[model samples]
Every structure is written in C-alpha cells, then in structure tokens.
Target chain A: MVPAADNQTRSENETKWQLGMLLSRPFFSIGRAVIRWINILGAATVFLFLALVKVFRSKQLSKIVQQLYYIGARSTTIIMLVSVFTGMVLGLQSYHALVKFGAQGAVGTLVALSLIRELGPVLTAIMITARAGSAITAEIGIQRISEQIDALHTMRIDPLRHIISPRVTAAIISFPILTTVFDLIGMIGGYISGVMLLGLNSGVYFHSIQANVEMKDISDGLIKAIVFAVIVATVCCYQGYFAHMRRDSHGAQAVGLATTSAVVISCVLILVSDYVVTSLLI
Target chain B: MNTPLIKFKDVTKSFGDRTVLERVNLEIYEGEVTTIIGLSGAGKSVLLKLIIGLLKPDEGTILLRGKPVSKMKKKEINAAFAQMSYMFQGNALFDSLTVYENIALPLLETTNLKKSEIDRRVMARIEQTELTDAVKKFPSELSGGMQKRAALARALITDPKIVLFDEPTTGQDPVRKNAILSMIAQYHRKFGFTAILVSHEIPDVYFISNRVLALYERTIVFQGTPEELEDFDHPFKDEVIHSLEALQKELTGLYSKRQFKVLNHAQMRRRAFGDTYCIAVFTLEDINSIIRYLGHDAVQEAIRRMGLYIDKHFGVIGGFSTRRNTNEIVTVLPYSDITEAENILKYFVKDFQGLEINDIWTGVRRRVAMAGPVEFTILAGIAQGQPIAEIDSVIDSAKSHQKEIWTATMRRRGEKI
Candidate 1:
C-alpha cells in the first residue's frame, strides 16, 4: 500500500512538472529569440564601428570608388525607372483626389513634396537594397566560406579595412546622391504626368514646385537616405561576413540564406527607421 | 633544446556546446616542416588557425618564441601575425582578380611598396610559379593546378617567417599532388620558414615532413619524425593513416608501397609457414620515351589503364597491386607459386597488348593523336617466396628477372607498327 501511494505521488509530480514546462515553453522560446536578436544587434553594431574606424585607411579611396560604381552608379537606371513610374502614379492619384476638392492646380506641390520628402529616399533605398545590397552580401558570404577573409587575416590584412569599410563609406556617400537624383527624376516624371498628360498649366506646375517645396523637406529626405544607407549596409555586410557562423545552414546554402536574410532585414529596418526618423524630424 | 617557434600550452577551443579541441599541447620548431595529420574535422585545421591567430584558443596560452600570444599587446599581436601567412585549402584566390593582381595584393595591401616594386615582385612570383602566360587571366580562368600555384605565390610574396598550408593538395590528381608536395618541399628548403601543414595525404606527406604530428580525439596523439611514426603503435596510425591509405587506394586504384607491405604481412600471418606466394613486378619500359612522344597526359592515361587491367585480371584471384613508382606496378599473389603467377601474367600481357588505343586513350586521344604514334613495352618479372621476412629479397629477385612481355606502337593509319 505504501509503495502504491509513492508511485501515485511520483506520477502526480511528473504531471505537474510536465504541465508547468508546457506552460513556460513559449516564454522560453520568446526569451531565447530576444536574446539571439540582441546578440546579433550587438555584433552588428561592433562590425559597423570597426568598419567606420577604417574608413580612412590607405588605398581605401580606390575601394570606395569601386563600390560607388557598383552601388550608386550602376543602380541609377533601376532607381530612375522605378521613381518615374512611382511619381507618375502619385501624380495621377493626387490629381483625381484634389480635383474633387477643386484643387487640381495644387498637383505640383503634392507631387514635388511627395517625391522629395518621402518616396524618393524610401524607394531609392529599397531599390538599391534589392540590387547592390544582395550582391554585397553574397560576395562577402562567398569570401567568408571560401576562407578568403581568413586568408586576409593570415596575411595580417584587416578584413574590415579591406572589405567592409569601403562599402559602408560608398553607401553613405551614394545614398544621398542617389536620393537627390531620384528626387529630380521623379519630379520630372510628375511633370510629365501632371502638366503634359493631364493638361495642368505647365507654369502653375513649375511655380508650385518652386514655392511649396522647402529646404527642410529636401534635407529630411537626405537624412533618411543616409540613415537607411547605414542600416542596409550594416545589416547586409554583417549577415554575409558571418554567414559561416549560421547554425541553421552551412557552405553555399548558408550564403544563400544570409543574402535572403540580409535583404529582408534591411528592408524591414529601413521601413521601421523611416517611421522613427520621420516622427523625430517632424 | 632550441626554443619552439610556436607552442600551444594546454589550449582548449569550443563552439557553443561542442568542443573541437581540449587542453591540446604541441610544439612546432623553427625551420621544420611539421605536418599535422588527422581525420576530417579532427581539429588539425583548428590548430593551424590557432597558430596563425585566425582563431584564438578559448583557454590556455599560445606562445610564439616563448611569448604568450594571449598576453601580448595589440600591436605586438599584429607584429606576430605579420610574420606568418596561410595557404588555404581552396586556394582562395580572389575570383575577381587576375593572377597578377591576386599575387600582388598582399604586397600592395600590407606593405607601402612603390608601384614599380610591387609590379617587379609580382612579376617575379608569377614567373617563379610558371604563371607568366596567365598573368591577365582570372582565377576562374586558370586551371585548378594553376590556381593553387597562384595562391602559393601570393602566400610567399611577403617572404613570411612562418607559413601554414591547410591541405594544400586536397583535390588534386596523383601527379599534381606529388608535384605540389615537391614544390612545397622545394620552397621550404629555399625559404627556410617554419611550416605547419594540415593534411591527410599519408606516406606522401610523411616523405616531405620533418616532424609528423597526429591529431586524434581532439588532441595530438603522436609527435615525432616520419620514421618514428611508422613504428609508433597507436590507434591514430590504424584509424587515420590506414583509413587514408584506403582512401588513397580508392582514388588512385592502386595501393601505396607501405600499404602493400602491410597487406603482405597480413597475408603471411593468415598463411601456413611453408606456403609459397608470388611477387610480380611489371614495369612500363621506356617511360621517358613514352612521355616525350605522347605527352605526360598520355603516359598517365596508359598507366591508369594498366592499373585497371591489373586489378581486373589479378584482383579476381586474390592478388593485390601497387604502383612501385611512376612506371612500375608491383602485384603480390597470395598462395600462388611461380607457375600460376606466370600463367596469369601471360594472359594479362596478351589481353593488354590487344587493347584498342581507344581503350587506353579515352580522355587523351585527341592529344595523343596530335602527338602521333609512340612505342611502349610492358615487362614482367616474377619470383616465388615462402617466408615474409624474405619478401624484399623476393621483390629484388622479381625485378632482376624482368623481360619484355608485350609491345605496342600505334600508327595514324590504324595499324600497329
């Protein structure tokens, strides 16, 4: 009878433990995810710092120029294509909506302000993220897996100095210029739709753009572009530079996963930081 | 004793929950080719990385010339690392860079050398590596062997005091493998740098290594000369060395000479005291002439075909074959006397002689056709022996009885001359 009683108690204890563990499992998973994200954030921050510090190293200018050609110059056509369509769509939509209020002449103010203050930087960032950001991640990931980075280390060449710094610098410089170009081209697109197609007065369109678009609006867009540049470059480079450390994959598969993650994380961060920056600036 | 150039003192390394190496202690002296051998993922590469500071040990001290690396200042650590270079297993030549640019990158990045000086150094290394014609070509454009040579040139461009080669001959054919090892040995002698190589090319690597360090079970199990390693009885020898020899046999379709001896011993142990076995040494005569007339690739093809034929004929009757050198194949027939061995050899010779040129020249036919006809002879020598102790004498006797058994010379007209 005593032995039966002990077994019953043991079963009850096991049931309680199991129930408790089941109830706490989600919390444990959440906590683990939180810790993992925090670790990644910290590592990325350190990576960015190391790369930024080496921005002025010898022969860095040449590497930076090379990256500029890849990230900024090469991205112009795609950015221009996307921006023009976006501007035209905005022009068409805003014209219809403002026409209902008998304010169709204000279309130029709306188009210029929208492109310069919001769509230009955001869309430009996203476009570059798709084009050059993915490439950088893949290149660096391949280098990491193939031990090219380790080879650099053994040669006493700091990989951050040789690889990442030039890229970060180039992106920081490129983002602003590309954003400005995106603004100009998108404004022209808006002009094409508003003045040429919709028959709004060309004079009114040009005058409204000149009068309503403030220096503050332009600067805000540039600031956003620069911030997005940092986010995109840091996240992409970090993911790829440490692709070999991924627990879920290895080798070429790890590189592919890193590239995907880099693009996804960079896009998400750009949107989140866009909101934060817009709110702070406003 | 002289101070070791690099020393790992009770070092431990781990990744998350898995410990790859624990409390590992080893010493590599200056100017010695110390090869670290182990199975895949046995921390041989981790050891090399630890020395070069590509990865640091989680615990314990790594001393360079008696100075603990972990205790050194940042600048001092950099200074120590600057004296070393690594040749990665994959060659790791920058895919975007041309051969000249790849080899020149180290000098351009690390040193403040003038452009002309860098060009001169790069050109010299390119010529030395026999990559002069490939100067403008990217790594992807170069062949595997050429890429390895480019990587070696880059590693040696700095004239580093210490060099680490991580499986330098991993994915190479037997000829290229030996060529790379010989190149490493030659450069080691010329540069007199401390070299730590991670490899599984047993016996081959042993021939070039001054000190052999065997890593097994996360720690170095043996450290001694290659001769000492042969006599040193350990699980590492049985597991890693013997298994790699087995892999070597699979890759080349022939046993190494050491593996042949091991098999001979095992066969003798299985047999009665007075049981007679036969040793036949088949030599591909006038190998230099064949090489000269038909090119190196054709010669290699012929040898490979010969090995395949030997296996096909002798392997059925429990006979094993090994390539004694570049031109000779030694077959050991267990429980067979001279008469049986001769009979088998006659059949093999006749079959081999009647083989179409297409059979032996499948891959190299175009090259062979361009080079025209070449005459080559197969010579076979046989001797019977009872005692395992007299196996060497038996082999010597077999070599002495070598006589031409078959000859073939192909003409462009599809007729044998």
Candidate 2:
C-alpha cells in the first residue's frame, strides 16, 4: 500500500513536470522560430540584392528567354481557362442580382470591375503560386539536397545569379502580362454571358465596361500583380534555398515539405497583400 | 620551406553547442595527395568544407595559397574557388540537365568561352570520363558509378588548380574504386594540382597519398605518410587504420585483443629503428571472488563499467586494455614512461573509490533498486624494453611481487588482507 501511494505521487510529480515542460516549450519554440525566420529573411534579401546586381551583368539572354517561356508561355492556356470560368460565374451572378433592382444594364460594370480590378490579379497570383512557385521550390530544394547548388558554388558560379535571377525576372515580367490576358478573356466571357445567355443589351454591356474600367484601375491591378509575383518567387526560392538547412527532415520529404510550405505561404500572403494593396490604392 | 598550398592555423568550429573542431592545425603542400581519415561524426567532412569556405570556422584562419580564406571578400573567395574544385561524395549531378549541359555549365556560367570551345571541352571531358554514350541522358538515367564520373567530369571541366574529393570511392566496387583513385592520381600528376581527399579506404588510399591526416577527438591527431601511420603507436591511429574492431572491445568500448596484436607487431616492426615498447598488466584483485558472490552477468557488467572508465581516462594517452586471461586484464602502453604508469596507478585508486555502480536491470518491466558502490583492489606489473616473448615472464614475476606487497600492506592495516 505504501509503495502504491509512492508510485502515485511519483506519477503525479512526473505529470506536473511534463505539464511545466509543455507550458515552457512554446516560449523557446517561438524564440527559435523568430530567429530562424530572421535569418531566412536576411539571407533571402541578400540573395535578391546580389541577384539583381548581377542579373544583367552576366550575359544569359538565352537562359532568361528559356525561363520566360517556361513561366509565361506555358501557363497561358490554364490562365485562359480559369479566367473564362470565373468571368462566366461573375457575369451570371451579377446579372441576376442587378436584375432584381431593375438595373440589369449595370451587370457589365460589375463583372468588368471585379475581373479587371480584383479577381484577375489575385486569382492569377494564386494560380501561379500553385503552379510555378511550388515547382521552383521543389526544383531548388532537390538541387540543394543533391548538392548541385554546392557544385555550382564550387564551379565559381553564383547560384543566385545563375539559377534564381532569371526565374525571378521571368516571373516578374510574366505576371502582369498574364493578368492582362486573363482580364481580356474574362471580359469576353462576361460579354458572352451578359448578352447572349442573359439576354441583356449588347451595346450597353460593352460601353459600360469600357467606360467603367479606367487606365488607373488596370495599372493598379498590374502593379499588384507585379508585387504578388515578386513575393511568390522570392518566397519559393527562399524556401528551396534553405530547405537543406532544416535538420528535421531530408531528401525528398524535405523538398516536398518546402514546396508545400512555399505554395501555402505565398498564396496566403498574396491574398492578404491583395486586400492591403486594394485598401491603400483606394 | 616553401609555403604550404593550404594551411589551417588554430582553427575551431562548432555547430550550436557541439564543437566539431578545436584548435586544429594542418599544412598541405603543393602537388601532393593528402587523405584525411577518421571515424564517422569525427568532423572529417567539416574540415573539408572549411577548406572550400562552405563552412566558416568559429575561430582561427585558413590560408589557401598564402591568402586567408575566411577573411576574403566575396569576389576574392569566388576567385579563389574558381581555381579549386570539390567532388562531392554523393556525386551532385544536376538531374534536370543532360550530361553535356551539366559539363558545359561552368563554361557557360563562369567562363566566356565560345560554343565551339565549350562543346570541345565538354566532349573531351565526356570522353575522359567515358560518358560519351550518356551525354544526352539525365543523371537519374545513369548508374551510380556513371553519375560519379559525370560529377567528376564537371568538377574537372574548369581545370581547377586544386581538387578536394570527399570520399571519392565510397559505395563502389573494388575495380571502380581503384580506377577512380588511379584517375585522380594520374590527373593530379598530369595537371600538377594539389589534391586533398577524405576517405575511409585506408590501404588503397595509402598507395596514392603522400600524407595521411587522422582526425580524432575533434582535432588532427596524426599527420604523416602511410608508413608513419602504420608505424605510429597511438591507439586512435590503430582504430582508424584497421577498423575500430581491432582497437576496441565492441561491447565495452575498451581496447580489445587486437590492441595486443598491434603492440606486438609495432614492437617487432620498429625494433630495427631502435624504438622501445612497454607493456603493463593490471589485475582486479579477487574479482573472481566478487563474481562468485554475485552472478556472471553482474561480473560482466562490472568489467564493462570498469573498462569504460579506464578507456575514457587512459585511452587518450596511448593506454588501452585487453583481457589477458579469465580474471586478469592487461594494458599495453607503448612508448610510455615509468612515471606516467605510476601516476595512472595512483589516479586509479581515487577514481575507483568515487566510481558508482549503475543498476543494469532497472526498467518498467523490472523495477530493481540501484546498486551500491563497488570497491576493488588493483595489482599492477610493469615491464619495459623487453622482447615480445620475454615480456610475459617479467609481468608474471612483477605480478607475484606486487600481490605479496599488497597483501602485506593490507595485513599491516588489519583490513581484508
């Protein structure tokens, strides 16, 4: 009976100690996390600055063109598909909502404004983050894990300049152009839905859209697209660049985790920054 | 003397709280293949990474060709790296890139070489590595050996003045290993580049290495030619040369019977060079009586614990233990002085008194109480400059004399005489 009581007390003491440890873990974890992020951000900023300074100094025009092809030209079909579907849904929903107030002519303005000013850029950024950003992270992470990045360093080739800069520049150039294509196709889809499907007046639909969307609206969205592009590319490259430094995981699992983290982080940041930029622009 | 091509002066490095290297000093001369060998997790890779500036040391300076690498500017370091090439152990071939493109990468990225020139150089390297057939294939398509050759080709494509190889022959067949070593040696000789390699292939590496550096206890413990490595009397060097099994008892981490064999071999081999070897025998007095009181398992546990303590204290200073007979253990201390042996014997008494015996059978399944303090007496015999055959006689006489003295001293004290 005494031993059992002693065992119970020992177990209670152990549980209390474990609970204390559990309570203390978050503080240390947060501190380590903060340090890790600061280091990552500092290294990433250095990489970006170094890449930008040396990006044009080296003559890799062919390589940049190759990257532009991979990032932009290959993505056009998917962007078109997503834009057309989003525009059709927006057109259908807005026509029904505006029809209730007996002002169905304003459906064109709503669809065009949403597609050109908000949905086009945000959706394009999200899609690119899902497609290209994840891929870049995995590719770079694998290179890091396989030591190709180290090999490049040994060869006296700055990996940031040779591997990352072209991809970044291509994404920056590609995003705005992709947003433009998405807006154009989305407006066509809106016109098709509002006029042919909803039996709205075609003349009013086209005129209202043209009159409502100013150059500033388009330019503002393009600027947002550029910002999102930079954020996504930088985040992906940073995650990949430092994936090997993670001691908790390695090999394919590390690369996979890095890719998922890159995509998720970039997408969330894109949405949040989209709201922030919209509020600031307005 | 001419300046060494690479020099490490009091270099120290640590990762977090773990110190990987401590005040390491080494010098690698030009046009020589120096192989560094050590146990796993002994900072062998850290030393190689330090040379290439992939890892920065916490303290001290590494000079490459009279220039301090750690203090160099980015451009300076890159320029220094341009003349140096490192072949990675895992053969870091770019998977997405074809063999030709991978080999052509340095020319494309660093050098402003023309397409024709780049192609010519790439083709030459491909031919040299015998990967012409797989020039268009990706790294994943090639076998491990082929990928290693491709990586080597890429490393050598820029014609670096210095090459660092990290385990160039690991996980390879003997034929491939020999081929790789010969290729490295031949290219090093032809190009007149200094080569530094970290490898576990000791006997094979001995043929190509002009010098060998052994890393032990986070420091460069031994640096000399292969002949010197073979002739060195240090227990750590023995562990590195002929597998750790030869130097340590696997279960106890104490010096095994192989240490005695090595001592005998070293004594015989160094006799012509006029070097003297010594042996000392230590017996745990009445250890058998204690075993009889306890059990066989407990006796084994006690010996293991005692061996661990002795190894931790004495192994660093060229002292290692092996079981001599059933109840006796002998420590063979080569190049040892009488004072050092006497000091060790004196320290052991105090150390043994303070030592605690851990309960080996305590767990959730069997809740056993911790064991009490273990007490023991030790009798020792020392023999110096004796032939391997005659050393046993000397130890026997010394053992009998020491036992008699211990008994008389205990009798005088009225203890357990």
Q: Where does model 2 sit among the CAPRI classes?
A: medium
- What digit string (tens of lDDT, one per residue) describes model 2 on residues A1-282? 568989999999999999999999999999999998898778878877776676686676777798889888888888999998888888899999999999899888998889889999999988888887888899999899888898887787778888888888888899999999999899888888888898999999989988888999989999999989888889998889889877768888999999999999998889899989999998
Q: Write the per-residue lDDT of candidate 2 for residues B122-191, one digit (tens) a residue.
A: 9988876667689899999998878888888888988888899998877765445645776677678668
Task: Considering the two chains of model 1, state its CAPRI-style docking category.
Answer: medium
Give stretches of model 2 more than 4 Å off: A1-43, B71-76, B244-417
Q: What digit string (tens of lDDT, one per residue) describes model 1 on residues B261-360?
A: 8889999989887789999998889766665455444566667677777866799999998877667788999979889888888887777667633576
State the local distance difference test value for candidate 2. 0.76
Q: Worst lDDT window (10 residues) for model 1 chain B?
A: B363-372
- Off-target runs (Cα >4 Å) in candidate 1 are A1-25, B246-417
Tell me how far the alpha carbon of residue B63 in candidate 2 is from the true structure, in angstroms, after superposition.
Answer: 1.7
Model 2 TM-score, all chains together: 0.71
